[model samples]
Target: MGIVIIGSLNMDMVVRTSRAPEAGETLFGQAFALSPGGKGANQAAAAARLGAEVTMIGRVGKDGFGRELLEVMRQEGVHTDYIGQSETQATGVASIVVDEEGENRIIVVPGANLEMGREDIAALEPVIRQAEMVVMQLETDLSMCEQAASMAHSHGIPVILNPAPARVLTDELLQHVAYLTPNETEAGILAGMAVNSIADAEQAARLLLQKGVENIIVTLGSKGALIVNHAGSRHIPGFPVQAVDTVAAGDSFNGALAYQLTSGKTLTEAVRFANAVGALAVGKQGAIPSLPQLAEVEQFLKESARP
Candidate 1:
């Protein structure tokens, strides 16, 4: 298996407006779109779009949203046989608002996603064991994330954990993660510091590394990414693009990084490719809709390499 993503699946309800509304103040939206998203699902789709064979393991409600989510995954070529259906919980959903600047604010309701339990992971053991790499996120139950990471770690499979929604994670989970991809804010929270620049990111990543993460990649949006390992750190500059929406940019990076790493690219090269992938993702809208296919990514990289 190429990549196995164990996390959440949600339908995104997005509205475009000039900016986020003030407290109790509503504004007229410019547009709206319903898109399939969930950190796990997004990463899976992003990798698949880049020519990686991906598999998804998560839960969705036994509703229309669930059906559509699974169907969409199938359309993206993600293996969805391991995805479970929740009996009591509704499918997860995200309420998002995009501004004229392409910035977005989101609130996620994790319904069926939280229903994923240890038993479900047990049932999915064979699939997990077969993966060349395991991708995960914090959108699901923290216990489930830890369990999956532990399982893959024991089997000597590399694990890429996207600590989103910003939480201070336990070392138990960090030790198992081969790659911990956190945004600037996430890195700050994890290290009990304020990360506002490359220097700050380096310090935060070092602190996080002491927590036992094999490596840390701090995504600094347009500034690029900082790679921190036992050997120290290096910053890979980002590819500038006309960002229509920043949604899924980090997911796109994680997926592309996993793809390139498993394909034998070095960490620096993988991050560079992932940066290009993220640049492509931000130029569009929605989550899955923003991911670029392999040819597009190749062409983008080819063009970017020009003088």
Candidate 2:
């Protein structure tokens, strides 16, 4: 079975700088690049490259960017048959700034990505049903995410919701998500608390569980991730690597986790794989360009494995 990703697709405009500018301040950039991105598209491409048959379902514009976006997915072997092109809006975009430390700041313009809704979901129902897992993010309309999650959960299929670009979530939405992957910042926002430590993340994860989330994984940057469920909590350490651009690390993690999970890896095993994927992603620049292929991930794991 394959993975179905229903979310946003965007062209990433990236600039490399020593540091981000402050309010009313200007700084010169060292370099600039453009690549295929968007949480949905990044995750889809990541999964596809890691050997998952991926079907991407979302809206793009009938513009040059849209065509380029579709072509990129095709090259990565992601199924674009269900992707819709909007006649009225331009394709989505993300303006990203990466500092010398590999930290990033991003501003996203949803554009046609916001066009996904119940109608698009209805049209893509068969694809969703056939998928072993459904992945989503907050870039598109929340209702669309909810609808997709609901539909997949109803069919007994697993739904993995990456609550990125954080926002308040409903209990109804949490109820349907089998796996809730939120970074520390997003987990903090959803849990109504400040997540500055692993303990804080565990508290937030507990809160999400109360909200009906079955399993919660709070990604902790360099500290790794905290996986929480009714069974208990365990801290999965991150893989260390030279940082380049962290833009796609989280997306890569989500995609790799979904791929591993759907392929029958246990939760802990899947997360370790995701951590490797994230570490590799940050070692390179650009978005989809940074995602590691299956062989790359396998080799990375082999080299990084402990004796």
Candidate 3:
């Protein structure tokens, strides 16, 4: 079964600095690069590169960036029949700064992404109906996200919501999600409790599970990821690597998880595979371009084999 991604596509402009800037301090950046990115596009590319058939549903502008973004997705083998072009706005854009420690701060200008509506989602009903898993992110319109979740749920397809750029999700929405993947901060927001350790992560996941989600995964950066289901919880440690730019690690993890899930792997097994994919992602630079392919991930896993 294929994976469907409904989210944003943007031209990402990133700069690397020695440290993040203070409230009003100016910091010197060591390098910069422009890449094709957006949470949806990134995850789609990641899954596609790992051998999953991915269909992307989103909107872009009738601009150069929009054209290039579509071309990039096509090159990555992502099905873009549902992606549309908006005449009223430009494609989305993100300005990101990565500090020496691999932490990032970003500001996104959602152009055509915001233009996506119920009509756009309705057009993808056929595609969503055939998919085994539908992955969504918070970068697009909340209404669109909710609609996609609802549509996928109606089809009995599993919906995975990566609550990045964390926002409040209603109980109705949570009830439709098969899995909720969040970072520590997002876990705290959703759980309404502090998530400072693996124990806390378990508690937070349980809290979300009680809200109707079947499972929850809390990503703890270097501490790896915490996977929680009715069975129990486990901490999947991250692969050791020197991170360069961590811009797409989370996206990679989500994509990898969807791929494994659609392949019929158990949730715990998928989390392990995603943890490895995410660790490999941090060892590279840039988004889209840095996403590891199936072979690359295999090689990394082979070399990092444990006793």
TM-score of each: 0.99, 0.98, 0.97
Candidate 3 achieves a global lDDT of 0.91
Which pairs of residues have clashing backbones in candidate 2? none
Supply the global lDDT for candidate 1: 0.93
lDDT of 2 by residue, 149-255 (tens): 99999998899999999999999999999999999999999999999899999999999999898999999887778899999999999988989999999999999
Q: How far in Å is the alpha carbon of 269 misplaced in model 3?
A: 1.4
Off by over 4 Å in 3: none
Q: What does candidate 1 score in Cα RMSD to the true structure?
A: 0.8
- Give the clashing residue pairs of candidate 1, or none: none
Cα RMSD of all models vs. native, in order, equals 0.8, 0.9, 1.2
Error (Å) of candidate 2 at residue 226 is 1.0
* Residues 220-254, model 3: lDDT tens digits: 88888998888888888887778888999999999
Runs off by more than 4 Å, candidate 1: none
Q: How many residue pairs collide in each prediction?
A: 0, 0, 0
Find the 10 residues in a row with the least total lDDT in model 3.
298-307
Candidate 2 overall lDDT versus native: 0.93
